[model samples]
Target: MTRLNHQEKAKEFDKWISWKQEGNKDAETELIMRFLPLVTKVANRLAIGLPATVDKEDLISFGRFGLLDALQKFDHTRGLQFETYAMWRIRGAMIDGLRENDWIPRTVRDKAKKIEEAYTRLEQEKLRTPTDAEVCEYLGMTEKELQQVLYDTSLAAMVSIDEAVGEEDEQKTARHSYIVDEMTPRPESVAEAKSLKEVLSKCIDKLPEKERLVVSLFYFEELTLSEIADVMNLSPSRISQLHSKAIFRLRSALTRWKSQLL
Candidate 1:
């Protein structure tokens, strides 16, 4: 698509929206062409840290399909911006495509599950987040074995944040979308979210200093695991283990916090 000035693009968008709603297939195609760069941008962001075998082009292709889905389902009358809504669907689609391709091995998925279950169970029993040593004892694994499991499942963790919530329905929604909304939220929801944010902040602050640092660098600073490892003077695998442990703590805390809210 040719570049258009802001006013020209707005005018063109209005025309396209009218034609699209009137069932003009060409208008739809033009819209897709105009927004193709957005898909590429989202694809590149998601493609980070993926193995070389997972081609970036393939992710872009998958994201294009997602953008198409968003175009089909989007509601312009509701005041939701197309870019933001499409991003959610686009990322979800790319992740779903990866999943359909069996990007995570069954063994790795199983190990991730075991670790999450061990943490959940031990935390509930102990009435607090379990230590790495405690989790190792509960899972009958040496500290080394635990770290290996964490390393192997780290990619799966990267793909699936929903596992943190431990409910299928909740898992269907992105954790970020669930705990927060950038678009308009109802006034009551805003109040509830503010309170929840405070609770979450406290929970994060209470994490072991190392785990807190890992969470801060990864989520706040947007650092890759290897980058975090370099900063902490640890192996990437060790950082992955710490990342997994920290997630388990947050997941458990959030589950409890949500329950109380209900």
Candidate 2:
């Protein structure tokens, strides 16, 4: 099938929605066939750069279920276009699949859960996102320790909410309601982000042992200078000095690389 522009897709979606409400099975099948590629594309993008075990095709399958959900729950009266509403469901289905598949190790998942909980508590208490220092303090770890944890466990990053909640169709299963907006970045931007991550990893590896440890503990583990000092058995001032020097070196390296790229 030919791809449609957003406006044309929206019209097609509305017709499907109307036909679906009247118990039209054929319309439902047609809608699924028409939009399955879009759902698969979103799923594939979400799985990009993940471990091979993540299985992009599995995410696509999960997204198919989410697509059905979108078809059923869409409401034209809300003045929201269907594609805008469906993207979230599609992504959410993929995440739910990941969770069910046990792709993330149990220990890492536990750590991620703790981090999430800590963030939640901090938000409730402070009414804002918790600072990196606050997270270190809460965990009773030094800054370096926190950074190590963050770097080592960075793969545990939470799924974006854009891929989490969405409206569900009445005739379909009760899927989470997610708000979809037009914030999806271009594919090239996604590729650049991946390249930057690889570069950062390489840079981290090239640091002197002490500087590398400091960088890992401070940035990835989310440790404050004092906390890192405690772990390294040094004064907070010393840890701060090390951190400053490491950051300067990293910035200089990245600057040179960017200049070369340009």
In terms of TM-score, how similar is model 2 to the real structure?
0.46
Off by over 4 Å in 2: 1-14, 113-155, 160-262
Model 1: clashing residue pairs?
Answer: none
Q: Give one digit per residue, the lDDT tens place, for model 2 in 1-262.
A: 3657889777776666667567777777777777777686666445422454667788888998888888777775656556655766787677788778877787865765565566556655885445668977997888787665544333345342222211333322111121111222335344544554555567567656776787777555646555677888976545544553344344434444556667
Query: Model 1, 144-169: lDDT tens per residue?
Result: 88877776676576675533222443
Residue 52's C-alpha lDDT in candidate 1?
49
Candidates' C-alpha lDDT: 0.70, 0.58
Q: Lowest summed lDDT over 10 consecutive residues: which window, candidate 2?
A: 172-181
Error of 1 at 227 (Å): 5.4
For model 1, the stretches where C-alpha displacement exceeds 4 angstroms are: 1-19, 22-27, 44-55, 125-128, 163-172, 178-199, 221-239, 258-262
